[model samples]
Target chain A: MMKIVTRNLITYATLLLAYTLLFRFGLSSLLTAEKWIWVKVIAVIYGAMIFVTAWMTGRRDGKENFLFDAGFRWNLTTGIVWGLVSEGWFLLGLHSNYESIRMIHIPLLIWSGFLVLHFSLFLILKRRTIGGVHKTDIFE
Target chain B: MTTNDTFHEDLLGAWEETYKKGQLTLWIFLSLKEGPKYVTQLQESIALFSKGTIRAEEQSLYRTLRKFYHLKMVDFSSGKGHKGPDRKYYHLTPLGQSLLQSFVERNILLFFEEPLKDLLLS
Candidate 1:
């Protein structure tokens, strides 16, 4: 479990780092005048990709149990959360002399909140369904 | 040359083409025939089974498993522990077993087995 969490954390952190770098360096130059519009456009596109990918990937399962499909659910949620954090930081506080580093706090909070909610909900649900340690579960 | 160098080249060449078409999915299911495996274990077994010719990326492998679970061809349950997230151990369903059997029969096991042997031996 630690291993999986570590891998997920590393992945999420890396993605967060990459996006932060891009937003700070790349976007600063490209959209000096009307940066907010470009950010909104990118957020919308990112959100769309997330939804489309989730829908297509889970198309095989039909409606039943599709929501529980971890890959689709995780990706879609991650995309939505990420899109919000990525765009929200700038939107919430975009002073002409804003320090980009200060923007990290909100995204970090959102990421942590997401990880907490997702894992807690999943663990609770799994405990209810499987019950405690039992012999049949082990061998079968 | 070392085995690693030989296989790394193969990864960039023939394997990439095959993988793009989802041939790796068979190898994944095939590896689970003996018993259930966690995702990391499954990845290791597949690479060892193929003698380093194929190494599945984590995202793709998990996505495939979820797809299989949705199709009812496979299922998973958590391993014993109260640690972080449960370690999901995946096993084939009866449906998955039949599907794998038919796949092997149609392709002739040699189609996969022979190439792997020839790659390692030669």
Candidate 2:
């Protein structure tokens, strides 16, 4: 389906861009932003995206967000790896001052935003495994 | 009746039981997907789940998702396309796929009713 293709493209493309930009700059740039205003603004936007994404996801899943079964151990590990990988990529970009690095906040925030969902999902799934589904009645 | 139908009847009965008791939160979950959808979209899509069949607060929907978070059947992540917060979204997990698969492939707790009459009705 077109939607699946598009989703895959967007997901992978964003991932590719995240790494590309990460290679372009260093983590230091995050702390050493040319404009603190954009940095904060982007952070707020990223935080919003995190909240909205989780909220929307919650609505869709009906309070049983199962993907989180993997738990915080995996989520946090992936989050850190994701952040580090992007940071490393951006750090690389910073050295050459690549023109490809536009809207620096977008990709960085995306990386952060994923972390939030990762945590939620981890919690959800882990909980389900522990609690078990509500017992189904045998007769109608 | 054939053995298959006989078995399906039993499964169907179980599905009905859970469905009636409100324990089958799993059904509402299948309606939600990875893409963004309005509340109305879900209300219409699920099987035997007509409009107003299960009225819920927007917040309640999120609350139910708490169990799913536990079940590991579904999850949410950030949307790729927008900056706005109005449109909500969700996606199923590997476990959810397996759960749905068990119903279809194994015919475990399969539901067949008048609306979809040809299915294995109990």
Candidate 3:
């Protein structure tokens, strides 16, 4: 549903924002340019977009369903997309310092952020499976 | 609290069944704990914590969540909506929380145990 999509957007967006801030002000020293404000703004914009997707999804599920279990598929899909965006384009661009701003370094930044989150969620899901998993899943 | 005086026993019963039936267990627990929270909150919660069933499948999760609401283990509130009105809310009974606590506690501790914690790598 549109709602779930929006929710996923928001979740991804918020996480992106957090990372942007962390890299910008929190870890701004790494950036050669300290005067740039685009990082924060862009992070908020795109980050919010991600959060929106998560929020919308949440709304669609309405806390009644086990979205935790189902959300994994996206993780795989997101991973493939992120791999291309993050390592693929990112290294290609950042290595040579091509523009490296205004969505230049942004796509991969967002991708990595989502990657970490997705992996974390996967780990959690794996645990829950172990926590509550029955042998049936493995053997049959 | 004493089982006789609290809903813990019933809550645990639900949790036991939760593994067998993922989302339904979660919805039921949420309904008991939060008093009709929006689905947005639940999704965010699961994403953040390793507490319940997540990473299973998308449409299925969506389907089950919807089903519980229809089943009446969950209810919507008049809070408008934080994620949006398009978002629905859920509230769990005290019975539900206690049940969640049982397995959650055990699993949490067990999860942190020897081979699980990666102390070997550490």
Candidate 4:
């Protein structure tokens, strides 16, 4: 259990690092004085990163490895779904009337929390499914 | 016969048929004693060791392996086959070894001796 949690934490950390680098170096410099074009570029990079990670993580040879827990399709699909939802929510926040700098951070924070929550949930559910079979007392 | 002996007899009677669902686990464990084996190897070994009296269909064998994998009694790892795509190898765990040992010590196969003796004497 500890091993699974640690591995997943590593995956999350890697994801965060990737996004930070994407925005900090790639998006920030490219988007200067032109927000939409840079956002599109960053979106494309993010999409490509999702595809690459999914492919790497889903490799058949890595099935027994620690990193292959939730599987490629699960990770990529959930991420894409959540990303779209977050984008919509961010847009909603922008269009809303009571907008402030403090409120602006809320949607992004919630989206980040959703990522952690989704990853953790997937791990727990998988562990439970595997662990549940041992309850049959086959050893006894 | 004593109650335990009768129960043993009954169990052996049930295990006599090679296609029975119950004996598949024992057969799988017996086949794995040497080391890790691929699915095809396991299938061939079971049939050969049983003198062609026992055989497992590919689907059933795959399902059994999946269950054993979940139960942690076996480890499934990929290995290159001499020909074709990579084959999944099944290795018995220590837990599996001990459990199979317990089954052997039970002398379940002893029930076959009477029939064997009759055949030899005749």
lDDT of 4 by residue, A23-59 (tens): 4445434544456676677868776776666465445
- Fraction of the reference Cα-Cα interface contacts (below 8 Å) that each candidate reproduces: 0.00, 0.16, 0.00, 0.11
lDDT of 3 by residue, B1-122 (tens): 78675687787777776655534455446344644555556655655454554443444445544544443434455566445555555564344456568856875566677787787458
Runs of candidate 4 with Cα error greater than 4 angstroms are A5-19, A58-62, A66-104, A112-128, A132-140, B1-28, B33-122
DockQ list for all candidates: 0.02, 0.09, 0.04, 0.09
Q: What is the lDDT of residue A21 in candidate 3?
A: 38
TM-score of each: 0.40, 0.32, 0.28, 0.40
CA RMSD of each candidate after superposition: 14.7, 17.0, 16.6, 12.4
Chain B fold agreement for model 1, TM-score: 0.72
Full-model lDDT, candidate 4: 0.62
Better of 3 and 4 by TM-score: 4
Stretches > 4 Å off in candidate 2: A1-140, B1-19, B33-51, B80-88, B104-122
Q: In model 3, which runs have C-alpha deviations exceeding 4 angstroms? A: A1-140, B1-36, B50-59, B66-73, B82-87, B113-122
How would you encode candidate 2's per-residue C-alpha lDDT over A1-140 as one tens digit per residue? 00112332334335444543443343335545565465565556554654454345434432333222333333343355445555555566543332234444565578578777876775565554345342221101
For model 1, what is the error of residue A137's alpha carbon versus the real structure, in angstroms, after optimal superposition? 32
